[model samples]
Target: MTLLSTLNDDMKQAMKAKEKDVLQVIRMIKASLQNEQIKLGRELTEEEDLTILAREMKQRRDSLAEFEKAHRDDLVEKVKIEIAIVERYLPAQLTEDEIRQIVLQAIEQTNATSSQSFGPVMGLVMPKVKGKADGALVNAVVKELLNNL
Candidate 1:
């Protein structure tokens, strides 16, 4: 099923079950999707949908990191739960090793021999790993592998 339809079903279930956290996150996700569609004035493709979902995941991860740094346990706990909910929708993430292999192939394709080639290597890697891996993690991997070259 499409993300929206799945969210709608989950929303109904959450309401019936009175699961406040799930309901709130589902509402937020639906709103984000609807807002994007309204902003673009077109139906979003599946890839665009995944892009939005990935952005949501990234935003939560950033918030989680900040919360942890500030030692805000209360907020940290809440954000972690939200992150878990977001994870339910995302595709299975690429392992570090899987990501490493992809980065190696990208570096090979671009003949990237130094950190200066980071941009070209990343350009080649992101599409192959899009929605299946975190951009920040991919960026770090590219940087590390290029630095070793």
Candidate 2:
């Protein structure tokens, strides 16, 4: 099944099981996906759905950080739960070493010798890495690699 379908199924199961936290998280994800579909005015392809899922995951991460800084452990725990739920739909994350290797490959492929070439390198790299790698992590790797070149 597609990731969206899997999410729908899990949502139904959660509802049936009366799992409040899981149900709420799934509902939020569904709303996000639906909003994207409406905005695009077409059915979402699997890749588009994955992109939406990734975006939702990013929001949860941001919320988690804010809750932590605010010293709201209860909210932090809730966001963590939501984050876990959202992550179930994401592609497997790339490790730091793997991301470093990919960044190096992108630089080589683009013949990027300076920070001036960062955009082109990123354009070529982001599509390949999106959903699997964190954008900030990838940016850091690119900066480090380009700076030393």
Candidate 3:
């Protein structure tokens, strides 16, 4: 099933099971998906759905980091759970090693021998890794590789 339908089914199950946290997260996902559809005036593709899920996961991770810095363990734990729930709908993420390999290839393809080529290299790489890798991780890898050149 598509992520949207799976999410809808899970939402209903969460409600029936009285899983408040899970239901709340699912509702948030549904709302985001619906809003995107309305904004674009079309239904989302699977890739688009994955992109939205990734964005939600990224937001939760950012919140988790801030909560940790503030020593808010309760809020941190809640955000961690929310991140896990959002992750259920995303594709398997690329490992750092995998991302590095792709970045290396992009660098070669773009003939990017220095940090000056960061923009072109990233433009070439992001599309290949989008939705499957974190932008921060990709950026770091690109920077490290370019510095070594």
TM-score per prediction, in order, is: 0.97, 0.95, 0.96
On lDDT, the candidate that comes out on top is: 1
Residue pairs clashing in model 2 are: none
Please give the CA lDDT of all the candidate structures: 0.93, 0.87, 0.91
Ranking of predictions according to TM-score: 1, 3, 2
* lDDT-better candidate, 2 vs 3: 3
Q: Flag regions of model 2 displaced more than 4 Å.
A: none
lDDT digits (tens) for residues 97-139 of candidate 3: 9999999999999998789999999999898887888899999
The residue pairs that clash in candidate 3, if any, are none
- Pick by TM-score: 1 or 2, better one: 1
Judge candidate 3 at residue 63 and give its lDDT.
94
Full-model lDDT, candidate 3: 0.91
lDDT per residue as tens, model 1, 10-48? 999999999999999999999999999999998888888
